[model samples]
Target: MILEAVMLQVKEGMESKYEEAFREASKIISSMNGYISHELQRCMEVKGKYLLLVQWETLEDHTVGFRNSNEYQEWKKQLHHFYDPFPIVEHFSRVML
Candidate 1:
């Protein structure tokens, strides 16, 4: 599985609204192909910081399948504006221990 990670810094005073929009945008992402699961974690020490983790069956499932779809536009419309500076999304795979 591929893990997608993003560090989101929401605009000041927009945390609540951002969370609400995130909840709505979740549906759009969840319905996409090859999506395994996702979680949004708020930072306890930072008011506007959040960590978003998403598991996908493949990198293209997100980089292409989702990002290329119309649903992505909806996702962007809902949550993109809340970001202070745009977040960088990175993908990872499990490392053998």
Candidate 2:
């Protein structure tokens, strides 16, 4: 499995609206191929900060299958405007110790 992490900085006073928009956008992501699950966490120290974590079966499932799909456009339309400087997304895999 792969984990996709994003640190989101929402525009001031748009937290509630962003959450609502994310709720709708969540459906779009959940329906995509190779999607495992996802979670959105609000930051305790920062007022307009959030952490978005998503699980996928493979890297291509997100970087290719999802990002390249039409659903992503809708996802962007719904939640992109709420961001201030935009978020950087990173993917990770488990490491054996």
Candidate 3:
């Protein structure tokens, strides 16, 4: 499986709204091809920092199949406003784990 990790640094007092927006945006990603699963984890030490993890069957499925679709635009609109300085998303494959 391929894992897409997105790190979000939400501004203070905007956590709730960010989370709500993500909740809606996730549905869009989930409906796309190669989507395996999705999970969001919050940082215990950093109040507004969060990790958004998405599992996919292949890299092309996410980078080409899903992102190329019209759905990505809607997802971006719904969730982009929450970022203070935008998140950097990276992908990885399970080499050992």
What's the TM-score of each model vs. the native? 0.97, 0.97, 0.93
- lDDT pick, better of 1 and 2: 2
- What tens-digit string does per-residue lDDT give for candidate 2 at 4-92? 99999999999999999999899999999999999999999999999999999999999999999999999999999999898899999
The worst-scoring run of ten residues by lDDT in candidate 3 lies at 76-85
Task: In candidate 3, list every pair of residues with a backbone clash.
Answer: none
- lDDT, model 1, position 30: 96
- Predicted candidate 1 versus true structure: per-residue lDDT over 29-68, tens digit per residue: 9999999999999999999999999999999999999999
lDDT (10s digit) by residue, model 3, range 1-97:
8999998999989999888888888889989988999999999999999998999999999999988889998988887887888889899988894
Evaluated against the true structure, the overall lDDT of model 2 is 0.96
lDDT of each: 0.96, 0.96, 0.90
- Give the Cα-based TM-score of candidate 3 against the true structure: 0.93
Q: What is residue 14's positional error in candidate 2, in angstroms? A: 0.2
